[model samples]
Target: MTQTTEFDWRPFLLRWSGEWSDWSDSRSDDETRSEGDEAARQGRWLGFPPASEERIVAMEKRLGRQMPPSYRQFLKVSDGWQHAGGFVWLLAGTTDARWHDNESGLADMFEEDLDEDAGPDERRDAEIWRRGLQLEVESDATYVLMDPEDVDDDGEWAVYTWAGWRAAPPERYANFAEFMRDMHREFHSLRAHRTEGEPEFANDTTRELDALVEKARLMALRGEWERAGRTLDEAKEYGRPRAVGLGDQIRRLLGQTYMVYFEDVVTDPRYAPELLPSLVAEHAAHSYRDDSTLMFHLRGAGDDVVSSAYATLERVRDGTYRYTAAGPFGEAVERARELARWGDTDGAWRTLMDALPLWQPLGPDHLAPMGWVADPLLGPLLTPDRGRELLSTPRGGQAGEAPARSAGLDADNLTWLADPDAHDNLTSYRFVLVEGVAPEDLPGRLADGDEAALDDPMTSDEARRRSLGGQREFSSYDDRALMSVGRAGDRWSFAFDGDPAHFDPRRFVSPAAAAAAAATAAGAGARAVVVWSGLRTWRGNPFFHLSVARDGAERYAFTYADAEIHRTGEIPRALDPDRFFGSGSGKVEGEGHAEAERSLLEAVTGEFGVHLPRHAITNGRLHTFTSRSWTRAPGNGETYAVISLNLVRE
Candidate 1:
């Protein structure tokens, strides 16, 4: 052969093998080997092939994109050496180049290279060597081939193209490009549908829920509580499960609505018979676990709701409904009071009895109304003995014992008695008299002063008057002197020196005045008053003193002197003088002082319902000047006095 240009084919071999390997792998192995054998036989195909250009045009047609020139050149080389393993030698100045193994090819080139120095052109070519086709060249060279009859088998060809060939661009183009286009189309279609379609799916359910709540609120704002409650019921149904925070929000709304409705329904008579029970039941169900909320409903429901609340309260008290002790107990007491007020006394009493165990532990405040069971129509149910018994029993360390005598005197009985006159018919009085005689007669003889001598059966009426008249100016027997008359109602009265200018004996000495005075005195000092009746005689003497003290200090004192005059005929005649005063002393004296005192004391204490101790009595003597003493103690105290007086009335 004529000497061929010494071509260093290493660079060309690398580029050609890399390209051919990729293209051949993209095809089936059978196709690649057949192409290689054909190329081997056709020596012209050993160099760059003319078929590469045709392949580029085919790929362009298949991809619908034009091929770059550089990419066409790269494909040409790839097609030429599709399976010619290493190197291809071209005949000098001719189109034929014989393929040879790389090692042999390089060795022969090195041997030839010793004789000829490398030229600039050769060095430049060496520097430009690239093993694999550039991305743009590969893109132009690639095509996804599928059997025309097996279009449905594109997935197999697509995977094969990605894995076998190193044609990443072709793989991405085939899968991702088509996928993104379909996604875009779908997105546009959805956008258009959203813009044009009726918005039925977006219902105003939330708005309906909100509107219901708002309507309820507006009703509340307008004070139309019943309407508000109806609206809230609607709201509860509307907001059941769908809305966020709906349960809690509706619960609160319903709570307020029901509370207002409960109050209005219970207080307004028109609604009490029908609406109250339903409201209470609904409230109980919703607020069962919440004692404070339950309490709100219980209290708001007022008297008409008592029966229902009583049932619920009984459950709460019985531990069926869990609640703080104070809440249920308070509600129970309130309900009981309501029942009692509405003439359901038995029901009220029974309810209270049921609640007592629970309330007792909660202490006095809870038991306040129960404690009032002793009032009027309710009082007959709570007898005095029962009251004392309840009061005496200890509940939660609170002693139910009777209050101190002083405080007890101030209790409601005496404070709220209806009839003041009825008091005198209730209690009795005992009058003790102390008399002073001449110093010589003090040891054994009772003094017979002018007033005293009037009682002697032998003394003439004239003698008694002259004696009383002679001693009257010198004696301390002025009408102004204070003297305990008798117990009347819850109070004790005494005669006091009235302001002479304002004193009208007719009024001051009147039974009405005396009754008023006694009540005033008792209330002023928180002391129960004791009255003395002159009709009650002690050793033929009608004289008595009444005394009251706290801590042994005298709060009040009164004395009644002169049995024949004051005791025999004082109150009855003072009350209605025209009826009995003209009668003789004997006729009046026959009205036993002891019986009157007994009756008066009983009437007063019974009417007022206060207990008075007998030791609080004090009797003083006339002329001898008996002294009574009192010591101040924190509670009720006793007073002592000597009463020595003799009365003889004409």
Candidate 2:
């Protein structure tokens, strides 16, 4: 039941999507009928039937977001599929695939321990739903939640699953595709084992759960709470309808996610006992890595519960995060006074919402101070009589999806177009040809004569690579690409990457900035100018395909938390397309980006006769550079002349 990094989900999605279908039109009547009969015999899964587009659209509207590509396509093949009586359980269909509501939530497993006086209001369920959309799988006992809120740049949400048992924290998969792909294999293996009498994970379901718990324990010891939490959830299902000693041990291990390890979170030697009584006081508000900062802030609160709550609230607004993975929430609001203070304030409204469950154990004496705030995850924390009022809110639309682009260009030449969370690597050819418009007939460029007109900052090639690398996982600036083009003298320079804290990008002052810069670099009479950039993930994964990794330092999808701004009117109307290719505006990546580039080339070559070529390595020359090195290898002596040429960054 532990989430694994070993599966390559892309291939599986393709195979499943194309595997079984309405018999091909080209097949003979007898062959088609036989295939159809066989599929019908297999029933739900083997006879996969794609759901209607209208149905998918309606489902997306109901959920208020898009489903992961593989999941959506899987539905196209089989709107719903199920397997019973073994490790495989219930897999919900389009009709039943809805986000969990306030009433029928898995968190209710904690009901026995919750006090009526201070327990979280119905809205807590709604809040959790905002962060993740739940889909039932496997006997209604286990469920997977799609976390679109914390996605990589490529719009792939990390998938987490939990068994509906008291205190079962969810474990995670890299994406919905991975979950589907791996789950398929697991079911096949489990079924095989059951039929073969192997018996490890088949007939004895409890033993299977036991092995899962062991795996989780090992993961927890190694600091992988997502999988650890996940495996334990599966174990909880094994002991369902009755509590087990094993589940208790699982909770203790999962608790490590929020607890500081053998050290004070506030990091101050002076306040020996931290201001927050428990290590979890600030766990939800900030990363555990910031021990010094947490200690400094926690020290300011002294021992007062109200002070600690307020401080945590402030920090949450200031932007703190739980590192690597999220932790189990709604378990600790035992403090009444602190909850009361947060319930009334604007400063820590979000913190209050996240921590409300902790305070549910308090009496009505603490009720007077509780209230509402404008939050995406806003819940019914206070009773109706307490009142819902406007309060401080984070900037809305932070996670909005990009609108569909209306530019009707046919996708033919291009292979893929990813809405890159940010800039491009100059390692491979990925020249961004903006729009299909001609610069000659338009207004002045986005930038003009002075450096002031081109306000975008320039940096080292290393900076470009670093920015792109970090974005392959989760990053703040994973939206738009600010394509910067410049020239010092005879050589043209360009580096397209994400926005970095240390770098700034120049805006266009005239329609001719980029074109004119290229023309100027090649000298006035030059017929064409070469512009180029490379493609790479932040971790330097090869361009054009998704790479699943255990962490950000390796290849993963280009997942970003926000939408791109490039599709807006930011680029010059003269040189920019209504929507850049690969903006995720109803277009796939590989083909979208490629076709967009091709169309742009057609327009530029036909209108401006601009010649695009390999990237230039040096400021004085245009070519790819490999760090200025040479190796003496044995060579066939056919060519004799020595040559000199300008190089670009390799």
lDDT for model 2 comes to 0.36
Local accuracy of candidate 1 as per-residue lDDT tens digits, 1-650: 11112223335445333433333344434553555445544442334534455666766575444433322343444433332211112111112111122212323433343435777434322221211111211122222221111112222111111122442321222221232222222222222233233332122333554566555543333334345445655444433221112222223222223333433324344333333333444454566656465555445345645665556445433323222224455576567554433223345445644454344322211112231321222332343433333333333333233322111111222212112332333222222111111222221111123322212111122222434454423211222221212122223222211011121111223222122222222244223333334333223445433433332133444334432223322232222221232233433344554444444444445533543221111111111211111112222453334334556999
* Model 1 regions lying over 4 Å from their true place: 1-530, 537-540, 543-563, 566-582, 589-591, 594-650
Q: List residue ranges in candidate 2 displaced over 4 A.
A: 1-44, 84-88, 108-131, 137-140, 165-167, 192-650
Worst 10 residues of 2 by lDDT: 622-631
Reference-based lDDT, residue 525, model 1: 24
lDDT of each: 0.31, 0.36
TM-score for each model: 0.17, 0.24
Q: Report per-prediction Cα RMSD to one decimal.
A: 41.1, 29.8
Cα-based lDDT at residue 267, candidate 2: 32
How many steric clashes does model 2 contain?
68
TM-score, structure 1 vs. true: 0.17
lDDT of 2 by residue, 382-430 (tens): 2222122111111111211222222212122222222242125332332
